[model samples]
Target: MSTRPLRVVVVGGGIGGLCLAQGLHAAGIDVAVFERDTAPDARLQGYRLNIEPVGSRALHDCLPAHLWHILVATAGDPGPGMGVFTERIRLLMREDAPPAGRDPSEQTHAVSRVTLRRLLLAGLDDVVHFGEEFTGYRQNADGTVTALFADGTSATGDLLVGADGANSRVRRQLLPHARRSPVPGVGIGGKLRLGDGAAWLPEELVSTKNMFLPKHDFLFTAVFRRRETNAATVERVGDQLRAAGLDPDLLVQDAKDDDYVMWAYVAHRRALPADLPADLPDVPAGGRGRRLRELVAARLTDWHPGLRELIARTPADTIERFDFATAERVKPWPTTNVTVLGDAIHSMPPVGGLGGNAALYDADALRRALIAVGRGEHDLLPAVAAYERAMLNNGFAAVRAATMYLRLATLPSRTVRTVARTFFRLCGVLPPLRRAIFSD
Candidate 1:
């Protein structure tokens, strides 16, 4: 342990944590990442995200030059014919809805969760410890923090960050009183190498870029594709596929998990005005994607022909359901020095895709705060308080916005849906609103 350098422990190795570690290290600060997983090769899967300027800027600013190239390599190869659609690709308004502007030329690359991790881990000098699940933390009066892990491992650092996802142990131990918001709806998605004739779904629809669909039933389909990789990864992911209620046998081959391109669709039953019950549950329970498909079939699809067509093409096994939960912002995130970042702090619905971006932003901001405090220029407590003030304000706003977007896509009324499409269109051309909507 180098007493000359500050010791920092980041509990989660997700986007935010990885970015934070990279940023601090680049700034000549010593940091270590303690990920619950044994290696980056194991158990991490999610669709591609639209990395906005906030996260893109942070990633480029924090990581090295080569990392940027890696991102582009993993990006979706959106072909020429890709177009934005409302009721269906052909059913919408006469004036063509332009595609979501993706700058393939930019530094931000659309990448798989694993690739992003690997990129961040580059040149890190192997400080990351795998299988070190966070148990808890304690702060000493001397300004040092002690961390306990599930494997009976303990480490001490100057500061602790909980970058763990929604089920963060650090957050639970620290902010025990904070309320856990149930996902307003269920989401299910999967990836399958498209069989013959399935190529009509444009490569753009499933590639590095994300595609959102509105079927007859209020179901929303989102697709993400990643290039192929190795076999063990495929096996683990294959096991995941086998566990699904939908027919896994339909998938043509068991390919490498990383290489196997896939799509994910999420639907909200509780989002429906009729399905929403009076009392909302405190903690979200649904994690299975199959439940979402069932809800979609029952509630959303009778009206749209295209929606039915898309659903008909989907193999039952591809759908994996999860609840889009958020944690209500409360006081003090830790009992001692432990604090949460990213989804652990504010787990918003993925509608805005702002969850990861917001977290990395927190990493940048919090690292600055810590640096300021360490230099004796500012008080640590107040510095953290100021950070939380910004975090809560922005986090709450994002949650509200994300939920609204998901609600609209899942069950858009004629007028509201029309306005949404128009607003998204205008967002491209309108400078001020674009700044407001897309600004940090």
Candidate 2:
């Protein structure tokens, strides 16, 4: 290895990438993050979040104590367990929020994705290079790696981490055989302002992670109420960053209008908006909200009246669209200076609340492993090999579980539905069963 201090080049500044950068700095290692977004507030992000345990723990591990507190301080209390319902709002069962098996101080039950990212970017203004799109990377002769960029600028480091989201260019270049196949259908989703849907929505829908399993499709809905408004969060987090020797004004986050209900409707490609192409890569710009709402309104004609209205009344611009895809068990490969993490290597649908959490888990796990190398406790290559084994095993397992959970809603078997309904009903009265099922 070169005599230079260890450095990590993280491509993509999403949850995983930024968190890893924070952890690396906390560990006294040198790191840099590159993101394509022109600035932090350039892209609008979904407001709701359902952070799982593995993810929450990772956030605690990777972020500093004050930063972690910023996440908790601005979030609402964790509500009761999520509820399951029939198409007409029939209560099937409710699975209470899992018990905090670990110390409560280490847990972050819930926080908006937007705010979580803002906190992740703390104290990294100088480390994270925005608007610099990553193209590819080449392994250096001295065992370092050099990351190429769209603008022809380059960043070389002892290691390269691909934390880019679902369509990671790093993964494409590093593992050519590892490809993401689209799920059979697409996900049509949007947000309904609290004022618009709360009055008509059932308490079960308002309070829990709501689910609707119709004859052949699924509808997932949940409320996202910010304890502090976006404006307040921005100012508070900005001050917190300033106190931590970071400049927040350089890439301040934009405030949102209001808290709302987030919902996703999963169906075949036929449910795609009439005006949009089926093979479109992502949610198109400008007319997306109106187009997705049209598709959802048509599909929910037979749903509950409240749900129908919720779908019908959701603002066009607030509506979101996405295609479905899942990452399978990543085939094993030789360890190198370059590796992958988060959605770049393993991604699943929004169901089961695993995607973001899994990414956080990857950040913490890799952070600790690399920290060991920085501390001279192990060699870089060996440390990475161990990290990849744990990461791939857990990451792929989470993907499989998330995809399976989503598939449960799409299964056409009447028998399967009946069994699931029975299980939910059974959990209602059985304390032991409730503990077993919701303890994750």
Candidate 3:
């Protein structure tokens, strides 16, 4: 181990980047985070995330106990389990069904991405630099690394980590050949306030659930049932945030909402025939909350009435369309002072809902490796190499698995859909088989 303290420059202030920073900071390692977003609310923080055991464990290991408490406090209402259904509300696999590898102690929950990010940002007052977009990096002859930002400023550190999302600049510079291609689908998603209307949705559907319609489209819904947010709860969260030195007001806005439901409609890119009305409006780039509801509603004409009504009644401003991308395969690179994690190294479709979870796993694994190096337990280069090896093996496998699952789910063949549905149903019955099929 080097005599000097290990200095790590993380090129992204996302979940993975922040998690690594927290762990390294806790371990007494010097780390800095650079984020392009000017402020915590620079953009609309996305919807809910299904945090699996791997991700939850990472948080448990990386986050300070208080922050972890906040995370659990803000978590959505607990569901019995995830359910799969058809467009007509035909139950294919119920959440009440026994899971394959049931671990009652290892419970997974849905959390708002925005809330999770805020919790991760806690106690990093001086470590994170906002508006510092990473442009690239250069390995110094002295075995150090210099990360350049768009503002012409740069930070030099013993090691560099590209936890930036899929379009990571560091990954681009290191492996220019690695590029993300479009998957054969598109998605329309939005959030709705589920106040009294919560009674209108099916109890199972309003809970954590996925609806796989036979029409090559899918709907995923997660309801954030109202939680007790009286003065005491607010004071507790406020006190925790202040104790962690985070801005208490950062969470005030979110606490105002009692309940919400996030929903998405995903389908093959070519679901709409070319012969359809050419005058259909295109979703605006920056608009949100229902801009594309009509276009999506038009495509879902043949879907179940309930599903179609959900789209049609959606507040026009909440809906947005996302063009899906094909799975990415990262090419190997020589290990050096620079490295990457999360989507920077392996970005895939959301088919398996493991993208965020995998990112957390990457953060935890990389943090462990780097902490070992900081403690002189391992060499820096070898530590990074080992981290990359494990990351690629797991990350690439996730990408491939998500790709395969997406292909099968969205393929316009009745035979393939039947087989896929049957396989999922079977996995529920066979715990060993479920363990094999479900990666995250």
Q: Estimate, for each residue in 30-144, the C-alpha lDDT of model 2 and write its tens digit.
A: 9999999999876456655777667778887888998886777566544567777888888777776545565644443657666677778878888999999998999989888
Model 3: lDDT equals: 0.75
Candidate 2 regions exceeding 4 Å error are: 1-4, 98-108, 228-257, 270-288
Looking at model 1, residue 59 earns an lDDT score of 76
Q: What's model 2's lDDT at 337?
A: 95
lDDT of 2 at 213: 72
Per-residue CA lDDT of model 3 for 1-440, tens digit only, reads: 68788999999988899999999988889999999999976644566677877888888889888888777666655466666776676666644533556542245757777777877887788999999988889889999999998899999999999999888888888888888988886667777777676466656557665655565667777666534453445676878878877665556456534466678777776875443222236834434444467667776677677777767666655566666675467666789888899988788888657788889889999999988998899989999999998898888887887787667656789887877788767766776776565434
Model 3 lDDT-worst window of ten = 272-281
- Number of clashing pairs per prediction, in order: 19, 1, 13
Error of 3 at 153 (Å): 1.7
Across 178-246, the per-residue lDDT of candidate 1 in tens digits comes to 666775565555554445655666443443333443442233333444333333334434444333321
Which candidate ranks first by TM-score, i.e. highest?
Answer: 3
| lDDT (Cα, 0-100) at 298 in candidate 2 | 78
Point out the higher-scoring one by lDDT: 1 or 2: 2
Clashes of 3: 13
For lDDT, candidate 1 versus 3, the one ahead is 3
TM-score of each candidate?
A: 0.72, 0.88, 0.89
Worst 10 residues of 2 by lDDT: 246-255
